[model samples]
Target: MEKRYRLRKNLEFRKVYNNGKNFWNRNLVLYIRKNDLEETRLGLTITKKVGNAVVRNKIRRRLKEIYRLNLYRVKDGYDLIIIPKKNVVDISYKELESALIHILKISGMLKG
Candidate 1:
């Protein structure tokens, strides 16, 4: 993902958590807030409770790739944060993508 499309600051994440509307499924939680920008940005959160550093990084990379591939299908002008649950480590990549897409669709962030 490009730098402009990634949420990197602590403040950014907090703003989304505090102000954004939330959506979730069995595997992931999604928080979304409008940014008034032309593109959507994303952040991913995977706590140590989920796994060790290697596992966390693997999940992060997978999430990023999923988001990157689906970027075009998502609506613009929103800041999105995705938090994975502990059981996420046990699921396959296709399941992870489906869970993310489920929340996005229900949240009205998925653009056809």
Candidate 2:
């Protein structure tokens, strides 16, 4: 809910999207790579095809909610980008959250 925390900006999102190597686990897809900073950086990308600006903004909000709730679980020291697919527009919050955790597990960002 704050710019101070959000990974806002097209260029930052684009850099991760284009250059970061991605790995996936279920509905959750991740682009993880090194970051120059001491802390982890996060970005979310939703295209116009996901819907108009309203739909896109909603999706972004939903993603940020997931990230915020799960921030404690996600590891630090990586630049991460999340992209939601068209089918995700219809999914429930539970499923979206599951996908996020699923991929994080796959990436080994979460260890138990």
Candidate 3:
């Protein structure tokens, strides 16, 4: 994702977590809140419980790619935080994309 679309600040992530509506599936959890800007922002969280450094980074990259691919379809002006479950490490890219899209759709984050 682009620099402008990435949510990098701790306060921003915390704000989204505290105020946003959340949705979850077997592999992913999504937290979304409205933002004032015209573009959407994305944050990702892959905890240590998921894996070692290499594994965690891999998971993070996969999630970011999934989001990047689907970015155009998602609604604008929202802050989104995605938390992937440990099971995500075992899943294929297609499955990861599917799970992420499914959760986004159900959460009303994806535009029709």
Candidate 4:
């Protein structure tokens, strides 16, 4: 059987582009903007700029995995859009996991 979470439209990916937020020393780039909703949502953007279809899908897969594994560690009431940098393709799952955790920590979603 398949399972799903309460993903809503407020989690829609909105563009912040050059106005995006950055946390140095952290390998992840989060473009966060508040959405007026009670449930948390995720919108992923993997463009051609990242690479070809295969590469883009791979990046998206890794990101989805990271988010799924860490979903319980996050807080509700906001829309979070994460964009992976080019360097992300070169890293392993553990590396990406750590990077995701780091971003959440800085975002004040995770403690310790």
Candidate 5:
């Protein structure tokens, strides 16, 4: 995703973690906090426990692509952090996308 649409700073992630409302599925956890900006930003966290660098990067790439594809469907003005669970390593792209969309709907972040 573009740099402008990504949450890159540690402080930014921490703020969202501390203040955001969260939603999750078996595969992913989403932390969402409203932001003052007109655009939404995204962050992804995949801990070492999830896998090696290659594996974690793969998941990150997939999640970013999914978010990019569905960007138009999401509401703006929020900071979104997605944390993938261990089980996510085995899922296909389609399943991951659906899981994310499910959590987004549950969080009421998806625009109609």
Candidate 6:
């Protein structure tokens, strides 16, 4: 993802968490808030409870890739933060993708 489309700052993530609406499933939680920009931005949070550095990074990569591949299906002008649950580490890629798509649909961001 491009720099502008990635949520990089602590304050930015905080703003989204405090003001955004959220959706949750067994595997993940998604928070979303409106932004002034025309394109959507994505943030990811994989807590230590999930695993060690290697595991966390792996999950982060999976989440980012899922988002990138489906970017066109999501709505514009929103900041999104994704937090994966502990169980997510063992799930398959297709399950991760489905979980994300489900959350996006609940957020009303998935285009038909």
Question: Whose TM-score is greatest here?
Answer: 5
Model 1, 27-68: lDDT tens digits are: 999999999899999999889999999999999999999999
- Give Cα-based local distance difference scores for all models: 0.94, 0.78, 0.93, 0.66, 0.96, 0.94
Over 1-112, each residue of candidate 3 has an lDDT whose tens digit, in order, gives 6899999999999999999999999999999999999999999988999999999999999889888888899999999999999899899999999999899989998887
TM for every model, in the order presented, reads: 0.97, 0.83, 0.97, 0.75, 0.98, 0.97
Candidate 5 per-residue C-alpha lDDT over 1-112 given as tens digits, one digit per residue, 9 for 90 to 100: 7799999999999999999999888999999999999999999999999999999999999999999999999999999999999999999999999999999999999998
Query: How much RMSD separates candidate 3 from the native structure?
Result: 0.6
Query: Higher-TM-score candidate among 3 and 4?
Result: 3
Give lDDT tens digits, candidate 4, residues 1-112: 0132323343244333334354534456776555466545666666677688999888888878878877777776656677777777788889988888888788776634
Using lDDT as the measure, which candidate wins?
5
Question: What are the per-model numbers of colliding residue pairs?
Answer: 0, 0, 0, 0, 0, 0
Residue-level lDDT tens digits of model 2 in 2-77? 5644577887777777887898754556897766765677888777777889888887888889888887787777
Model 6 agreement with the true structure over 1-112: per-residue lDDT tens digits = 8898899999999999999999998899999999999999999998999999999999999999999999999999999999999999899999999999998888798987
Candidate 1 local Cα displacement, residue 52, angstroms: 0.3
Off by over 4 Å in 5: none
Instruction: Give stretches of model 4 more than 4 Å off.
Output: 1-11, 15-26
Model 6 TM-score on a 0 to 1 scale? 0.97
Kindly give the stretch of ten consecutive residues in candidate 6 with the minimal lDDT sum: 103-112
- Span of 10 residues, lowest total lDDT, candidate 2: 1-10
- Alpha-carbon RMSD, each predicted model: 0.7, 2.0, 0.6, 3.9, 0.6, 0.7
